[model samples]
Target: MLSSLAAGFGLGLSLIVAIGAQNLFVLRQGVRREHVLSVVAVCAVSDAVLIALGVSGIGAVVTAVPWLLDVVRWAGAAFLVGYGMLAARRALRPTGAALHVETEAPPAERGGRTMVATTTRTAAVLTCLALTWLNPHVYLDTVFLLGSVAATHGAERGVFGVGAAAASLVWFAALGYGARFLGRWLDSPGAWRVLDGVIALVMWGLAFSLVLPVFTG
Candidate 1:
């Protein structure tokens, strides 16, 4: 049981540590200090739920319906493309002023631009949800891959799933909270432009990868 748990934790962390759209969004939010807790909770909880489904043998059902992934693949690609365009726009037309990190400033004092760097809690949460749920690779990694690995543990699969879920929580918490330290560096518009530019490239790259398989396969 201990060995299975350890394996699950290690594998889970490895899968999630990759540079992906969801991770990039979380990092951006963390650096902006905008809805960090909500974003982290959504990501971590969503991973746990998906991991639970996989361990419960739902992966078999998902596999049985190949069309389900097809639909998800197209939708994910579309969403990613749209998001990438938005990021590109931000990068190309950067706000001249540095991002305002001091949240205590009055709306008037902040040049009446409270909405510039920060977003509402609802928007933040919804974006986080879309980024998490709309990515087909997430299902492949957490549900199918992780589930298949857990099955090898036999009766200890449950413990393995728990370990995997725990890893998700730990990773997201550290990533979301730890990114605040980079806030000082992202204070300049040029820095923000570079970050958004990188985000746009990654988003479009993921989108293209998602669709390329359909045409190539």
Candidate 2:
């Protein structure tokens, strides 16, 4: 049971450790220090739910539907392309002073408006949901793939699944909150542009790789 759990934990970490769009978004949020806790918590919770669902026999259903897999593959590829384009645009666009949270005055000084403060939290939650749900690869990774793997363990399946879930929670929480160290270097607009440009390249590369197999085959 322990060995299986360890294997599951390793598998989960391996799946998530890639420098993908979701991780990049989390890292960016960590650097910005904008709703870091909420963002991490939402991401962890979402992953845990999906991982649990995956281990609960949903993998069999997903495997039975090959079309679902194909749909996810194509949709994920397209989303990656779109995100890459957006990142490129940001890199090319002139740097404007976006609202830095630290610079904001107290609500009383700002006309007693609660809208901006509330909106940030709302946006953070929405971003987490969108990031979790939009990418079909997440479903593939957590539900279909990991679930299938856990099925073979029989009695150890529960332990394995829990281990995997723990891994997802740990990784996202660390990435979402622990990445603040990078903020010292990336606080400047120029640094942000450079980082975004790299992200764009990575996204485009992954998208191209996804489609390349189809054409080559």
Candidate 3:
């Protein structure tokens, strides 16, 4: 059990450490103090669902459908590339105020009289789901990849899978909440620009790493 747990935790941590759109979204939300933990919670829960599905023999179904993997590969690659472009564009844009006070929009102009601030919460949830689900790489990693390794342990695979899920819950919570403490620094336009620029570079680099092998092959 202990060994299985260790394997699971290590597997989970390794994947979560990588910089991706989801982490970038979480980082920005943390800085904004906008339902940050909720974002983290959704990500963790989504991962847990996928991990559970993988552990419960759904991996065989995924493995059987090579087309599914291919579709995911292409979609994930495209999404990563697109997100990288957007990040680079944002980085090049002039820095703006860190926080903007909410303004009341005129009734007809508001489109159904919805508060902009309320809409941000919905956007956050949708973005979290899109980040988690749209990236076929995530399915490959959490399901196909981890699933294969966990299978080696036979009956102990369940224990291992649980450990990995726990890691996701803990890591994202820590990353999302712990990062908020840096909000003071992030409030500075120069600091935000530098941090976001670094993030953009890292995101683009990861995207290249994902798609480069296809051309090289």
Which has the greatest lDDT? 1
Q: By TM-score, who's the top model here?
A: 1
- lDDT tens digits by residue: candidate 2, 1-217: 8998998899999998988777887887776677888888888888888889998988777778877767766777787788789779878883454323332445323324331222387877775676577667789899988898999899898899888988988999899878867756774668878987998998888777767767997
Q: What is the C-alpha lDDT profile of model 1 across 1-217, one tens digit per residue? A: 8998999899999999999999999999988777899999999999999999999989999999999999999888898899899999989987656675544665334545543644688998998898888899999998999999999999999999999999999999999989977867886789899999999999999999999998899
Local distance difference test scores for all models:
0.89, 0.77, 0.75
Instruction: Work out the TM-score per prediction.
Output: 0.92, 0.80, 0.79
- Give the clashing residue pairs of candidate 2, or none: none
Give per-residue lDDT, candidate 1, residue 179.
Answer: 92
Worst 10 residues of 2 by lDDT: 110-119
The TM-score measured for candidate 1 stands at 0.92
Weakest 10 consecutive residues, lDDT, candidate 3?
Answer: 107-116
Across 91-169, the per-residue lDDT of candidate 3 in tens digits comes to: 6774344442122434223334332232277888987887788777788788888788888989999998998899898
Which runs of model 1 end up more than 4 angstroms from their true locations?
A: 100-116
